[model samples]
Target: MTKTVLVTGGNRGIGLAIAKGLIANDRRVIIGARDLASGMEAAETIGAEAVELDVSDRQSIQRCAEYIGPVDILVNNAGVLYDRRVLQNPGDFDVSMATMVHGPFYLIQQFEDHMRKNNFGRIVNMSSEWGSFSEGLLGPNAYGIAKAALNAMTKALSAQLPNNVKINSACPGWVRTGMGGFTAPRSPEEGADTPIWLATLPDDGPTGGFFRDREPLGW
Candidate 1:
């Protein structure tokens, strides 16, 4: 049976690459985007389905979860970068946390019980080295802070989930996405590699860990 995989922010960039790779691998893929038209366009191009999901909105996240029911896997890839004035503007920090931290948290809560009942599931949080204390939480504004919270959640949630269910954080290095800019050294496909790997891990695969390029990374 084919597993169903939903990737947030999958209309473009590394998320799109991950969705395409999953489709190619015989998984039932769904691309989530803030814009329905673009999401559908990307889904049609990639032979997958599309769902409207604005990770920054609580209502949107809840509605999206209801609309998509149970997914075998989830890729929490949606994110945004606020201006350098995060401290100067409270809304920037709020939006950052709402999108990256709270949104994924609610999505996971909505589906984790289903996964536990099925005794099989995989969750990949599209985290970054910026979230790492080792990396100095270096991402500008609240980006790193939000992702660090995400990484912490991944570990916390993993403890509550069953053995067959796996949840891990992945840092897709600077890829040539809009966020990564044109001069980035990596391609979206290259960035998607480790994420796709984590999404399809065997039962014995590591859980509650941070990784990049399929190797362990410190948080």
Candidate 2:
């Protein structure tokens, strides 16, 4: 059976690239974007379906889960970089956490049981090197902090999930996306490679780990 893969923020950037890569590999890809029109357009272009998903909102996430039903693979690629400094814009910090950390947490809780029952699941959380303590945990203030928390959650959740259900965090290095800026060294396709690899890991694949370019990275 073809697995249904949901890639959040799939309207553009690395998410869109990931969706395309999955589709090319014969997986059923669903583009989850906050904007229905753009999402639909991207889905149509990629020959996939689109679902409105605003990862910052719990109600939106719940509604999306209900609409899409069970997901075989999940790529938590939706994220945000707040405008102001952590102290300058505390609200933005909340926004950052809501999207990067809390949203993925809710999705995991909502679908983990289903995965457990099926005895198969693959989850890839889009993390950043900025989240790596060994690398200095440096980036936009709120973005770095929120992703560190996300990395922690990935490890915590993996411990409880079934052996067949693999969950791992991936850091797609700076890529040429709207978020990554034009000068980034990598392209979206290059960035998607690692996450796609994690999403399609074999039964013996590693779990509860952080990886970049398919290699383990410091947490």
The RMSD of every model to the true structure, in order and in angstroms, is: 0.9, 0.8
TM-score: which candidate is best?
Answer: 2
Clashes of 1: 0
Listed in order, each prediction's TM-score against the native is: 0.98, 0.98
Model 2 Cα shift for residue 36 (angstroms): 0.6
Looking at model 1, residue 114 earns an lDDT score of 82
Instruction: Give the per-residue lDDT digits (tens) of candidate 1, residues 73-182.
Output: 99999999875778788888898899899989988887888888888999999999988988888888789889999999999998988978899999999999889899
Give lDDT tens digits, candidate 2, residues 1-219. Answer: 889899999999999999999999999999989999999999999899999999988899999999999999999999998657799889988889999999999988878888888889999999999989989999789999999999999999888898899999999999999898999999999999999999999999999999999999999
How high a TM-score does candidate 1 get? 0.98
- Overall lDDT per candidate, in order of appearance: 0.92, 0.93
Q: What C-alpha root-mean-square deviation, in Å, does candidate 2 show against the real structure? A: 0.8
Give stretches of model 2 more than 4 Å off.
Answer: none
